[model samples]
Target: MLYQEKHRPQLHFTPKENWINDPNGLVYYEGEYHLFYQRNPHSNDHADMHWGHATSTDLYHWEEHGIALAPDELGTIFSGSAVVDKNNTSGLFESASGGLVAIFTHDGESQQQSIAYSEDKGRTWIKYEGNPVIPNTKIKDFRDPKVSWHEDSKKWVMALACGDHIQFYNSPNLIDWTYLSSFGKEYPSHIGVWECPDLLYLPVEGSSKKEWVLIVSINADGPNGGSAVYYFTGSFDGKVFHPNEKPEDALKWADAGKDFYAAVSWDNTEDTYWIGWMSNWQYAGVMPVSPWRSAMSLARKISLYEKDGNLLLKQTPVIADNRKEAASYQDVTIQPDTAESYAISDTAQIDLRISEASSSTKWGVKFVTDQEEVFQLAIDTQENTYTFYRTEGMIDFSEEFPEEIKGTLNGLDVQNLTAIVDRSSVELFLNNGLTVSTNLIYPQGTVTQLEVFAVNDVLQIDNVSWTQLKSIWN
Candidate 1:
């Protein structure tokens, strides 16, 4: 009966109690995926930061291992990355196959970088005696070091968030570090401070080349006015990162939704698996959930691709194997200004494909409960935008919770889209995640109806299918 609390997510990762934000120390080792997060162990609110640990063999069923790193004299733990020192690089292990080393931010009189190691697969951790390996340089907003090994440079590279930009540094054995160069001078920034920075090399789709991607998460002034992650496609030398300038004037968001912040990728995985904190700072402390206050987004497989001579990132969910197909439809049509409704499971994955349609049309789908709770997604072809709103659900927890968020389609045809609806959230992946929107919704009644409608023009549904996702709590 544990985790059966109301509004709990059945398919995502959430701490059993207290509060969690900014996923940290994501790594895979010895057939287990380790997810450490910024946790407040004493309350359901954000405070007294610590590193909470969990492990999963399949990344779906997680087992909590309690607190892995506690608040010490140096300060409470902030956010950071973890790596496997297979060659005894830090010399912290007995065998050549070294253990796990975590590079994180210690938040005390300012924020500084620190490290700890675990020999027994992250079951326990020992703080480094020489803590604060990288001291703060009088910068008030410095934290969240994401470290990775540079095979070409033969050194460990750390991407640290320093005030307005990211600072690059190189270390030989995860201990001594030297500053390299800084980025974000020419990049656009919002009204908020930057927190987490991740540097990743992703293979460009349809090409043999791989490009470097620098991801930065900003708060308070996102496109939707909360926490959001945006990135720049660039080239990273051992000493510096040169961003490839894009033609667009606005910031390129990783997720075009109200949620999805503090995103980071797992180290030492076969493929790039990215996850983010599934709540916004604007209302995270006031979410109307019990026992658990926040949850993590579904681990998504991300890739880089080229479109119109511009390199972009795409995200696709790592679907579980236990999902069952519940319904199917094909070649359905709806007249202008009309809608068709269907009953659906509370937890389900809906996939739909639209045939080539007129550019003057406006169509959408709405999820509803018997009590009139509603969450809607709409595509305006004339405006070349897709918009979403969750204004009719149980959204009174925060005054800032009710708003509409939109993403530009840029004249792309309405080909396909997927909506993964859980107990308290919905993840909309449009055009194979070339554009994604993730939002949290709370309905006092179970969402039992889905309605498809078109406005001013006919809508064509090429194919549609529905699958009921199994609950992990079961």
Candidate 2:
């Protein structure tokens, strides 16, 4: 059934056959969110890139539309962001200015930023004849336009991913863009080529204190292995960014997961929502099957909180409204002394809280198998931290040790963990949804089991619930 296999990690709505990657033009317009992506319309491989379009009332159930934009003599419609033009003022949408504006990279002979307008709310798009609004400045790998209207500046600002640094541009209208200064030059060692840049202002812990964040996905270097999102926390003073002191002080990865990449945020939304391509570069192009490739992480609502003087980004499921079928298992606890197992069908979400721990105890839950193959999320009470380890399974981990993939430990006194497991991915939220790690696992069979165990101390399972998820698209 897996055909035209693509490179990105996908959630529920994968077509039976096609190629998909790098979520583009993510915009909330006309009471629905529109998602465009990089796809090869004619075949299952990467060749002629086109913009594949889909829309959803909520982030979950998506309605696929025709190819939104294709390669012209001008170039292929590369990655970009979209905006809703409330007033029919921008001539880009001639008949109706109150439609949508798409700013993307046109990669013909060279890479340049281009603008396109949609009249019927993104159903159709017309490229601006006076194209290449931002000419290629000899920076070979320049693309992925993330544009937003800055209310304070009364203009549109763009964060374009340039090699090593993110280039900023200012525009009075959507058409004309002027190059501004670049950030991250001083911290060249900290990042590689920055791609898929997103800049937004968000409140800290529901407080009035708001800070602007510039998020860039680094393609060449990451904490895990491949690409990762690095953020800068600072204030934008109309023209340039005044960043914080240390790069790591302000820089942060979007997710502690293996599969997250090229994440972009929707524009002009009160609630901060974003989506990411969910496959790693290491595993791209080597998937088991083909015809259809790539997937998106479920849209996530983002928030910021500070713990131990470090800024952490929290992502929650934003597709709750589109959840058509949900089955819940409530208040199930296990004692620390023994190992217990429970059966899970296809896809399930579970929450666990482990209490009564000492310095020399281990507690965790295993998935997908009773022996040889299972994904494990555990806490070493002795180490006073949490760990995520996987045994023999769909992943061929014959060389590396099991503990190599161990994630950040929430310190001693860590008690709660919430986890969501679909067919091929696992997201673990530890210490009351504070620290998290996302991993991708291809389980061997359909009949999966949830197993839990503890070493020394009497492990107490405070609350455990597993909910079955129904298919979103038929």
Candidate 3:
């Protein structure tokens, strides 16, 4: 009865009650993937922050495990990272087998870094007596520490967001941290105070070498509007990060949509998987969802690839083995000014591939309800861009909700495309995940159909399939 609310997401993760934002302490340990988030247990609006916990063997179905970290004398638990301390590097475990160690921010008098250990697989936590391992040095916007084990120098690394730049530190035991270096003071794109900084090594698609990636989330100024993620690729010596490309050369955005923010990856996983709070700060508090005010974007498996001599990031959704196919089509052709329609459920995954397309082709897909409310995605071949429009539905709750979300195709040879559609969200992955867009919709009527229209040029589609996704919380 809890998740049966009108606009609850079936394919995404949402708290049963209260408000959640900025996923924290993401890690994979033993046989389960842990998702800890910033939660306000008392109300549907953000306040009284705590770290809420959940776990899943498969990324799709999750079991809530209640709160893991609460506000202590120092401060409220804020965004951070978790790791499996194998080899007992922190000397917290009695035996050689290390437990889970969380390095997070304590937002009290001034924001500072702290640590906690989970010996029972994150069920219970013990805050280190030595709180604020890395004390704040009077930085106004100091928070969100992302920590990981750096092997080359054989030291644990901490990437902390400090005002307009990211500060680096190293620790041998996750407790005593030493200052290493700082980056982003010369960075051209200082839109707002940086929050949620993550540093990791990502494997290049065609090469055996791995490159270091630093992700920074900024508030109030994004590619679209407010709260977006941007990343820089380069090399990280155990101490400092040197970008292969200058930060001022061109700013690379991780997600071009309005919703994706505070995206961080899970530690101790074979492949890097990421999740983000799927709401923009511009209109987050004013969203039309009840009971729970926020939901996360679908978990994206990320990797790096080279395109047109530029290294780019690709995000592919992890496919669940439990989805059931509802419909399939092959080699369907739509002439100019023609339209096709199909019945769909409230929660379904739509997979489509473009088999034949021309330079002048313009097409769009409309998710429609019987009440004539529509959310649309339009593709323009001439402009080499796609735009999302949600003007016809229940968008009056926030004036910022009706803005068009657009993304460039980068002259990509368009091929496979996918959309994960749920009761109140649509996540579109285009060109095999080269570009991803996420948006939240609150329609008065239930979405029951999908319509495709060719605005001008004829198009040939292939391997089209629709699969329904079961709700994790139902």
Candidate 4:
């Protein structure tokens, strides 16, 4: 079983075959979650883009519904969003049953926005005859339209990524867009062209006032490297947005990890949730894909919290990984360059807290075999950084592969951390989601042991928690 399909993720969302990227059109209606993705049907490589559909009553087990939308005269279907038009906004509803609308990008001679609707659940789809609803003005990079209904404005708002910045469009109905404003001009990091854009309102963690969050995904030059999602918090008064952060700290990463990208929230009336593509495009095309290429990250509930006067995103996985606590440590003191081993599964979650985290402290946790380490997580009190690396045990090791990814917290005073491990992925929630590191790791063989060690000085590790996770397929 390991030789045939060792890297195939049993937990993440992978198709039966071929290529997949960017979780598109996430919506919740009638007690079911609808997920549309960007896929290529012909081969393992990316090409003829189409919208692949899937449905899940609970976020864990999914049922693929084949292609939802295909290439038309307008062009191939690209990344976009889905929403339930409760009041028949577009008037495309044949009756009360026909109100689910999907807004997506049509990539042809140029890029433009289009709409499609399904009256009977999401089994069937019909494209709007009036496509290219928001025509492109020859912008070199114009795509990925994320639309949401604004209650305060009493209209629909669209957040479209346009080159270096994002454009805001408003419409009374789902059609007939009126340009409002543009953002992201030298205010934040612009290492690559912004692709997916998501704008939503989140209430401050403890306060009553809610703030708007703008999320942008870039291909390269992430803080930790490769593809990542960066977000900005500000005020959106129906038309324009005002940045609430200091100029130097305007943009913040959604996750400090290298894999999480193209993340967008699910449209819900009660709770806010999001999902992301769990592989980096840097080496996506070359992964050892037999029947399938990539998968989506675990669905996570998105919430806002305020600490030290900054609004931070707290992500909690929808599906718990706790099969049982296999091993644990409490108030263990480690000497310099000393290591300790614990029993763990290939898929697991580890929670740790430090009693004293200071400049002279350096610690690392390794997933290894008899000979070498397969994966490693490091924390440096001196540098004030957290690092995750998949340098060894990779099936197809390449110099082209991304290097160790790193993220930072103020004063590097991280006391608590949660690490979720899967067959080919790892998600690190540092300081309770203040910092996140999600990485893809294809080990050469099964991981055999877990070792925790300290360097430079004696470190006190306390409040340790361990869980041998169950398979999501089960």
Candidate 5:
């Protein structure tokens, strides 16, 4: 298989090649952050899904490890969570073998939840001889177990993806689990089917409001395939999840992107950080001639804020911890009917803040080519919005192609727009990553020129920075 590496966001890890889906077993262990993903190691296709392991000291530079877990007689090593057993409460590890324990779904063709044990610092794992530690209970689609230590009750709590609901369970030693209750089903609009559920406590800033967020990914049939993260803000009462409202009243999407799915968080750290597979079920396994078919969004730092009587989750780029490489470009004043162009090197990240003087909205930045091809990010002053439009590149979709597909854009609010362009990908972070559009652009060569223009009226460009990124995978 061809392993073409690209310079991605700082501290956010991605695979060198092949398909990567679902952020599995994300946890901080032994002074390092370990992220395991669903990877098809032998090929770039989506078959033979196995768990590929990688660890990082600061969530930036990653060191690859041997395959963490593979499909045993089981169907596939599906999604799950991991935690550090500080007090050896799981009993899977001894005092001498003090490190971590991973609890994941062993989809044994029958598609049931099974447990495995790892004593050697999460390297090699042995299936719990008492396979299917949690009985299927005949739930049609029970998978993606997220386990956390419930300090309130002082016991282990886990959430499972049951069709249209999240089934709660409790375990004392991480081996035996008892069914608690189901969380969603009364409210039809809450979510159709809750896949990949994460329940955690996040400390609200400047307050003692330790809010519990129950995040679930929904797959609704349609163009979007209904992949989204809906969260309920409340307090967990150990034995049960008593939302302030009914289950239907607690659903809110974490992101408004077309590609975010199967997101899971690590419970080992204090920070509310999460990563999601950045592909959709509608387009999964359908990329053309791609050596790798999928990727995860840069790990996002999540926070809860009360807006308009509702708790809104704000997601920020977690790579800010390693942004020293970004440098400010020369400030350029924009004049009506005047456009400025800058020649870029191999790989670059450009950040710009647009301020409108009057009211005309047609301002934008264009990635220009000598052959007259252009990719544009345009602002609509009248609509108070911005859009990312692509007019070039070969995207061979099996179905009819649009002459131009507006990948993703957001309404202009307080936050500015940031664009990270590598050799093969263009990730546009709109409204400070509240919304994002990630697209693959297989440019034949280096993109050397970038132009900014005020399409209609005079616009003030506050700051622009272009930083050449160093490739770590090479």
Candidate 6:
């Protein structure tokens, strides 16, 4: 079969070939950004796990660097983290802080965390002979070690997903670990076992206070089902993570979408940044994109915000909003129950501002080809919710993809909407960073036009502009 290059993502990070799942061992070294992932290099199916490698100078354009950590006598490589060993803490290299270190999980008889050091940046790695740094316990599910430096305690802290709650462990030399505490046993969304947990400390805006953000990804149990990313804002006292006080059963989600999962931050970055596997565990390898299976969401700059006395994490695209406008229209008024269509790029960024919205107004946008309607993003004022419906448009390789994904927000306050469309994904952000919806869909046919329409009531569009994005693979 001929490869459908049009279905390949242009701006997102995808492996040169084969299957990849979780984003692993992300770190910033000097000027280059390193992204290691859970990969199967031999085929487009999930097996023979290895840490596939890629490097980017600016985190926008990536260079595939083959595999970094392969399977050994212990087992195949799994999800973990990487760090720059400053001050020669691990004593793996002669130099002080320039040495690179990668901490990962080896899956054998049981899941165990191990350490590997690189003398020449992150290109080469040597596993610590004293392997299984954090030996396996009696638990069944234990993996994904996300490590960071805790200055107050003067030790390295690891946030790992065990079963339900993420456990905290303190390490002195990245080898020996002391179990501190575990969180999230019977609280919040315990629909499934947690995976890919990241603990982050964020400074509050214009305040002396700081809060710790823990990102947890769940599968089979999300707001939209299949897979999703959820988060909590609190303070970690180097021993235990104390989630901020909230009403009973109030759980916060990172991105209210089905696609984004196993997200983590970049180590040694001056500012907080993140990226996620743009796939759901439900249909990850089944999408059949051929040479490659999945891609990563665009890197996002993360910040903290206050809403209803709760500190929430807001994500905005790290890449600048610079693109060539293919077509644009401003303050276009839509008559009652009418539709409008315009030409657009296969990959584009769309901005929409709809004002004079009423309780009866039903406004939405659709991605379509001349022969088929690919996807639809519709807002229902009466329900005070936004829905992304793909039942009529998607090519379902499996029985996992959801027919519709809906998110509820203050629809009255929703005046601005930005949609970032790649060949196979759509990430929708509303009113700055209040709510985001990331969905993956494979249009059965070509997608070459954009359409906006209204139902039941007349609506006036304050502004509408779209720009075709350049391919990062170029």
TM per candidate comes to 0.97, 0.89, 0.97, 0.94, 0.85, 0.94
Model 1: per-residue lDDT, tens digit, 220-315? 878888899998888988889988875356677899899899999999997899899999999999998878889999989988878897877889
Best by lDDT: 1
Cα lDDT of model 2 by residue, 123-177, tens digit: 9998888888999999988999999888888888899988778889988788878
Q: Which stretches of candidate 6 lie over 4 Å from their true place?
A: 1-4, 204-209, 245-247, 320-322, 356-361, 410-412
lDDT of 6 by residue, 125-215 (tens): 9999999998899778899999988999999999999888899999888988999999888576767889999999886665777789988
| Per-residue alpha-carbon lDDT of candidate 3 for residues 385-442, written as tens digits (9 for 90 to 100) | 8899978778888788887888888677567779988888888998878788888888
Candidates sorted by lDDT, descending order?
Answer: 1, 3, 6, 4, 2, 5
Ten-residue stretch with the least lDDT total in model 3: 355-364
Instruction: Report each candidate's C-alpha RMSD, comma-separated, in the order given.
Output: 1.4, 3.4, 1.4, 2.3, 3.8, 2.2
Candidate 1 wrongly placed segments (more than 4 Å): 246-248, 357-360
lDDT of each: 0.88, 0.72, 0.87, 0.82, 0.68, 0.83
Q: Rate residue 11 of model 5 by lDDT.
A: 26
Candidate 4 clashes: the total is 1
User: Residue 7's C-alpha lDDT in candidate 4?
Assistant: 74
Candidate 1: deviation at residue 359, Å?
Answer: 6.6
Candidate 4 residue pairs that clash: 98-119
Q: Give per-residue CA lDDT, model 4, range 328-435, as digits (tens).
A: 778877788888777777778788887864323678788875446568888886788877776776545445464687887645377787877777788888777777
Q: Between prediction 3 and prediction 6, which has the larger TM-score? A: 3
Query: Which scores higher on lDDT, 1 or 4?
Result: 1
lDDT of 3: 0.87
In candidate 3, stretches whose alpha carbon ends up further than 4 angstroms from where it belongs are 357-360
Clashes of each: 0, 22, 0, 1, 3, 0
Instruction: Flag the better candidate by lDDT, 2 or 4.
Output: 4
